[model samples]
Target: MSETRTRVADHIKHSPGVHFNELVRALDLAPGQVQHHVRRLLSDETVRRAEFYGRTHYFPPEFDAWERGTLALVRRETARDILGHLLEHGDARPDDVADDIGVARSTLEWHLDHLVERDVVRKERDLHNRVTLVLTHPERTTRLLDDVSPSLPERFVDRFDRLLDHLVEG
Candidate 1:
């Protein structure tokens, strides 16, 4: 493999769920260059791709389906915050989690939708049918959580979504 390709592969291996644009920016390579290398990486199965909640994330073939999904969610600031909050607090009411995170309820629900659908979280209801967010695999989720730190672009996108959610709520 060429040095550029090696850089791309190693970045994906280390970051594990970095989105395409972020990868390009992080490596300071042109889009076409990154695309060519990433295509080859994907072709040889040196890397894998997973799409969850409208974002396509790249992995180093070491992550399973669940890990890929989990990584995808955790790569975003809002989703990571929600997961971290639930991890620390145990099962919590949806409103409380939203309030604690200081995100609009709709924004929290948006992330929770993917988080719940991906099995990172489960919405359990009491006899009165009140919803509480519970982590499906707390230990595994915590381990994954500790490993991921979102890129600046990822955090910007998440903050933008929160802004939109607040605007809509208003």
Candidate 2:
């Protein structure tokens, strides 16, 4: 795929509900140019768009190993950090999570919010007024990872291993 299409695909995979304007901003492409490529991507079925907040939001199609596919579109380094932290202890505060992931608080919050919005993770408020994170279903964690953006069933484990290594090395 062209770099632009890959960027669009990755953006949609990570932020399933992202709009054209946001895509334009994210990719630093003009609105018309972004729209053109997005339309092509949609036609190819490599990406999809959905209605959200009264505008069109893009996403990847449901496939076998969705989570790994979805993570591929995300900032891999950021995702590596976030997933590593979650898989280790299952949850943490947004602040601690930021530290764990080596991201700014706002960036971590962005990723967390996106994850929560996608139902890939759950959020809770604790007694100390701190935000707590948890994977909604432990049993489905593997499945969730598998289904995030769709991948071949055989590649799930291998991809996950690489994802882990990506995080660890970061």
TM-score of each: 0.92, 0.44
Task: Show where candidate 2 strays beyond 4 Å.
Answer: 1-76, 143-170
Q: Relative to the true structure, how large is the alpha-carbon lDDT of every model?
A: 0.89, 0.62
Q: What's the TM for model 1?
A: 0.92
Clash count in backbone of candidate 2: 11
Expressed as tens digits, the lDDT of each residue in 1-170 for candidate 1 is 99999999999988888888889889999999999999999999999998866778899887899998898888889988898898888999999998899999889888888998899999999999999889999998888887779878778989999998989897
lDDT of 2 by residue, 1-170 (tens): 88887887887776654566667877888898888888899898988666532556566786334343344333234554576578787777777877765555655665667677756677888788777888665555554444343224324643565456557656
- Cα lDDT of model 2 overall? 0.62
Angstrom error at residue 126, model 2: 2.1
